[model samples]
Target: MVAFAVEHRPEFSALRARLDEARRRATVAQRSLIPAPTLYFGARGERAVIDPREVRPNAAGQVESLGSDHRSILLAADVSLALPVFDRAQAARARADVDALTVQENLSIEARRVRAEVGAARASVAATRSSYERWRAIGGAVEEATVLARRGYESGQVGIIDSVIILERIARGRIAQNRSRAEYWRARTALGRAVGVIQ
Candidate 1:
């Protein structure tokens, strides 16, 4: 989802516009490359154009006239197909240009956003890791203090307030541990989203 939304950012509209323009230009180029099929023949009269092979001998053994004019012979010559030529050069060029532009725009936006997200996630992980380590280190000290304070209270060497303070320290350590765990999970989730994997 992160990857998909990042790709759909509003700036992609400009890329889409550029693609459309390129397509339009390609259409014009394509039209221009369409070879006119009329280069070999010209039409003049009611007589249909005839192929040389269609000329037949008359009952009197004479070649038939194609038309009233002797100079009106339609010459058949080699005509080249144009689509393949255009596709190999001009159309292919247009396609490559559009592809490069599209990749630039899309990847630029995606990379910037994913990098920022990754940075934030990494920072969160670091902070949570530090907190977790600090809390774990203090946990043993807090428990020892709590045990000593309880013993001192029973022996009348420490007051109820002292015990309460020690218990509060232990409670605070536990709370910090829980908070750190939550933060770690949150950071992991953010990192997952940043990397485009939705676990």
Candidate 2:
């Protein structure tokens, strides 16, 4: 039944999702207190280099051309990081974020309510099942008696009063059986509701 509630109920699933989202937000807020690190990577490729030539003053103050040592492609990478100095407000907000919401407690209460409902439903089912079994068995037996009583009356072997009594017993048994069957279905419906199924 616990598995049934967890597996079949969309309300419980939505609650779990909401809790997960809250935890994620709390974690994000917590991580905001520290510096954020980043990684940078890049690559460049070219068939030919147009700006390969470069001029610079040599040891004797003469301009030198560096095109002979140039490559067609260039690659670059760098890492950057930043830390917020004033995080008092964010830290306070992170601390203010609560783990337990009123709705979460209400969900717990709902679980207990479901448990009680399921228990009551199970008891009703048990009671109705026995009632159904008893009524159906008695109904079958009374129906046979009713048929025998009618045949006996027709053959002048039984009185009209006896025949009427048997017929009445059969009628009462049928009514009880019908009621028991209906109650059994009603109990099953209650159990389904407790377990979070539509039907």
Write candidate 2's Cα lDDT for 1-199 as tens digits: 8567656677777777776776666667766655444445555665544353576769999867765554555555455543445554465445436543644775687677777777888888898889888877777677787788789999998888987887787787777789889998888888888777864
Quantify all predictions' global Cα lDDT against the true fold.
0.68, 0.71
After superposition, the stretches of candidate 1 with alpha carbons farther than 4 Å from their true spots are 1-100
* TM-score of each model, paired residue for residue: 0.49, 0.62
Q: Candidate 2 versus the native: TM-score?
A: 0.62
Summed backbone clashes in each candidate are 0, 0
Model 2 steric clash pairs: none
State the number of backbone clashes in model 2.
Answer: 0
TM-score of 1: 0.49
Clashing pairs in 1: none
